[model samples]
Target: MSCCSTSLAAARSFGSVCSPPLTSSLTQMSSMLDTAAEQMMVHKDFQAALDTCDRGLESLANMEQEDSRCGEVKAGFCILGIQALAELNQWHGVLSWVLQQYEHQEKIPAKIMQMCILLYSKVGEPAVMQEAARVWLHCPSNSRVTGFRTVAELYLLHVLVPLGHRDEALELIVGEVGGSAFTEDQRQAALDVVEEKEQQKQEPPLNPSPNSETTAHTSSTQGAVVRKLEAMLRFFYRKLLLTGSGSFSLRKVFTAAVLLYMLFLRLDPAHPSSFMWISKLLQLLKQMWSAMFAPYHQALTHSKGL
Candidate 1:
């Protein structure tokens, strides 16, 4: 059969399966455009591939509602266009496309926003990075998907830190580090900062004042600092439990659990509720650990039996 005839037959079959002509039409167009783009890329005709992606995007723009599948098709086209632009070394073109497609949209998908941020960073466009950061950070924190939140936080820290946005980076660290809004690297960075501060507190002051008033004041200040740190540690622990596996790092989660336990022991020696909370935390940890290792254990048992 001719390619055109086969494509029409496939479209008709898809239309029969997927209710509504509009959805089937969009799906067929997306499939055709994807195939054309892929063929062009295979032939090293990046510009042709880019053109195919543009056509797909135009079709997407004409759609009324952004259904999930349609949105996926659009995102795929955007990614392909960006890749083509990158192949052509047209960084500005990529940025322009991003601005046109996503910058002014009322509701940008988190995945698309992440793609734009990464693309801008690749092009060394700090200004665009800042705008992306502003849009993402201002997004409703409660409504954010945990995975997207984690990526956004990492991108902000990676791109914004060297752009002299230390204050913003620190704000993100404090606000999102303990929550599921951080990757393992970001979590490690936070842990390092906290550990360093803890080590500093443990070290004795270089100069000792003899006056009793000075000693008393110093002790009072140190106590307050310890109390604040302990509170942050507790918050981190609770948030970790509430927002499970944002970065999907079991190791980081285990490290956090251990660190929180240590901090609790050191900081809250006499609290009446300490034992109860610790008991609960231990039980939770046991359940998580078993859940994580159960598959491996089952496989091991089967292998031994064999």
Candidate 2:
């Protein structure tokens, strides 16, 4: 991917420019940063790029306080370094490496925080950035940056919501931190979304059994019977796999036949004594039947579209 010209200089002096010089002028430091960028973009040598960024950041450390150019240059190198780490698939090290540069989570730049949030979210590990993003968002200094609201939103959606931190997410929407990040209407919407998620969590999972209210209320007898039969077979297959015992032995099949006989051939709903036992058995079996399924069933369903 192409990078900003300011962040990635031309590739003329693109040799590994590690430790340019402690006394590098703005021009010299700028050239050194180009080496790291070239290593990343042109050479595709991400490790070399990270090495160069490290040296450039070290050179810019003292100069950062004296010159605005130095800070920009350092941020450029940091960005390059971050991309290099991601390219290398060293996701686990990203947060720690960033914290090493800033010394504190709250001190990391907002732009970098935004990048980390997106990166971790992409890697399916948004929980990794939750604490760091939370700390940075709470920092008053970072609260006014242009990317502040973006960071807040990403943290809420990508990190907090995915990780199920409802209490903290709700607080962030209505609390002072959110006051600067989100408007009243957005806050209300966020609140609604959070509450909805909570309600979903509290509700029991929909049972796909033949005896469920959904199945019983169906108008089509044929469709209901088909669904119930499928559910029954799936439950039996899953239970056999889950128990990991006997490995689909014929003995298990015979046992199933006995239960089927008791239900269909023997049990009579008109008789109160038989009705009680049937209801109790169905209830117990329904409890035992989980949504879990064997991998073979999944493969079969996918291949045959069943």
Candidate 3:
């Protein structure tokens, strides 16, 4: 049999053994495989490409669990898998898979960015295109590789403006590209839209949502907290691994003592009680470090016990 024929049979057989695996484990494995497949794509081997595409499809088939993380992975894999199917002239599969993926993919920004153009072309659906525009406005500013502007333009002209959402469309245009990247002509075009909306309204512009910027700021803070917590846990794990459970030394004790000393610098501005607890924790930590390490240092030189 041809390699493609063998690969297709193997993919089908593997897919049929469908006892559900742990969602987290499956997601991690799928992501690892996806990254490896992406790297392997540089080789441009058709059989490998087919195998990679099949892996994505396999992940997509199992993505319907209640877990959001698994859903996100499935959505991503669906887009990638469909893209591969398209490249191979699997038109019927592409049609079926893209529709299925779109219906179930939870509509995240990255998936929207990945599949919008092709899906729009294939489906010729204005509503789906508008969704792509909505996602683009809220997508991260740094994600310029997505061509959000182009996607927005397609939706605005072909979908939103024609759907009698010209005013809403204008607001999105201003918010996305007005001040910095937009041309003078583009700015004027948007301003004309605002003026048009103003003529329809008796009052001034409505207040922007209080939580919009706050939500973005809070999201950033949460990301930082996660990173810091991960770093701390890794540090603790490494220390445990290296030190085994036991003891410490003078330099080690001194270093930990210095850390406790620095803890005093982070004073509680709100309450005196916090300061008291801070001092107490520091003292305890210092004592623990000293008890653990000081004897080790003493025994080395003087052969003395704590």
Compose the digit string of candidate 2's lDDT tens values, residues 237-285.
5666566634557437835764785667465668654554455446644
User: What does the lDDT come to for candidate 1?
Assistant: 0.59
lDDT of 3 by residue, 1-306 (tens): 122333233323333233455456665645544553453344535445546655664665665554544554444454445444545555345534555555532244343343444444454455655654565555556235344455555555556654557667777667654433356797677557556655666465588677999988966875674455445434544554456437345336545644664465453537553454445445655655565567667778685442
**Over the stretch 18-70, how does candidate 1's per-residue lDDT look in tens digits?**
33444565767667565645544457677787788778778778878776566
Q: 110 in model 3: Cα distance from truth in Å?
A: 4.7
Winner on TM-score (1 vs 2):
2
Per-candidate count of clashing residue pairs (backbone under 3 Å): 0, 0, 0
- The Cα local distance difference test for each model comes to 0.59, 0.72, 0.51
- TM-score against native, each model: 0.49, 0.60, 0.32
What residue runs in model 1 are displaced by over 4 Å at the alpha carbon? 1-22, 103-106, 141-143, 176-180, 183-188, 191-306
Mark the regions of model 3 whose C-alpha exceeds 4 Å error after superposition. Answer: 1-24, 45-65, 89-96, 102-110, 118-154, 157-306
Q: Which wins on lDDT, candidate 2 or candidate 3?
A: 2
Per-residue error for 158 in candidate 3, Å, reads 7.5
